[model samples]
Target: MCTAPGSRAFLEVGGRHYRRCEHCHCTFVRPDQRPSAEAELAEYRRHHNDAQDPGYRRHLAQLATPLLQRLPPAQSGLDYGCGPGPALAGMLREAGHAVALYDPFFQPDAGALAQRYDFITCTEVAEHFHHPADEFLRLNRLLRPGGWLGLMTRFQTDDARFAQWHYRRDPTHVVFYREATLRWLAEHHGWACEIPAPNVALMYKPVL
Candidate 1:
């Protein structure tokens, strides 16, 4: 029995299978078969998303567009999983939000976790999580009440084409989540969720 990082759902991949957890329903990749943190980091570095292209920015904006309008000026934010260049953090700062940058590989600063924030962004980072439950719970712990957690990732769809999907072609991607999964997460975590885009979601923890 393997508990997925976020949910307790049973998972079977590459001939490896795991029992589901009743509490979280997270489907996890087995330890022996799962990718290691070191192997995962090496593959993340191979992403060439730093190129400042209008098209690329627009592609990224697909994730940030709705957020640009929703986030208030000067609200604190964390650009979680900002790859080597920290582009999303720069964009949030340019938009006048006080943004802090952190990445397990690029900007792993001990102090980044010291304070809470009003918002957080994780673009193209969820799929690489080795233990999403622990990782996502950390994000939850870091977020202040009413803070927003934005994520950019392709939602899993049940289709024969997924195997051939370019997004999954990268060896780095391991975990898969669907739109319902995001919804499930928000409900379970007490956050209001919005999926304005197919690849983006905004979850807000209510100030109770």
Candidate 2:
């Protein structure tokens, strides 16, 4: 999100309030409506996303497969916000890449954030941001110039189906981005952006 001033009331679904950013077209839940950290952690713990599960691996492959194709050999990467099971990190590691894991709840390593990487994978992580602007700035700083940032999140498209959208139903999912929102982010940060696969975005930081 651009974090520009004005935003209008967007929707009220299941007693939660959402607002639409005028600058970036992002839909985000009102701050007061967001779940507490403890509640969010509890909700995340309920997920059974195993790294060894074939189906789970396949699900992650949507972002990994495309990202792998674009990466050079032996690149060092960070799997930012990797949930309890970091399946994507393992997949990237298997492909001859060095990947570090970092999750606030599961693997909180401050040292990992201190190092810069060649690429960063943020799978299904953006929507959970409480302050996307700050989080993205951190992501950009953690990447070396010309580094890649791969993201995978269910995009918000149909306003008509928003109420019935399964992605929005998740309590932890507080923000939603459209293709336009992603483009705005790329433009704001001076990165080249591409949609290599559905629900996936590949952003390349410019080399200074």
On TM-score, the leading prediction is: 2
TM-score of each: 0.85, 0.98
lDDT per residue, candidate 2, 67-89, as tens digits?
A: 99989999999999998988999
Query: Which ten residues in a row are the worst by lDDT in model 1?
Result: 1-10
Candidate 1: residue 47 lDDT (0-100): 64
lDDT of 1 by residue, 79-172 (tens): 8888787777777777888888888888898799888989989988887787776888899999999788999988867545554567765566
User: Model-by-model lDDT, in order?
Assistant: 0.75, 0.94
Question: How well does model 1 score by local distance difference test?
Answer: 0.75
> For this target, which candidate reaches the highest lDDT against the unseen true structure?
2
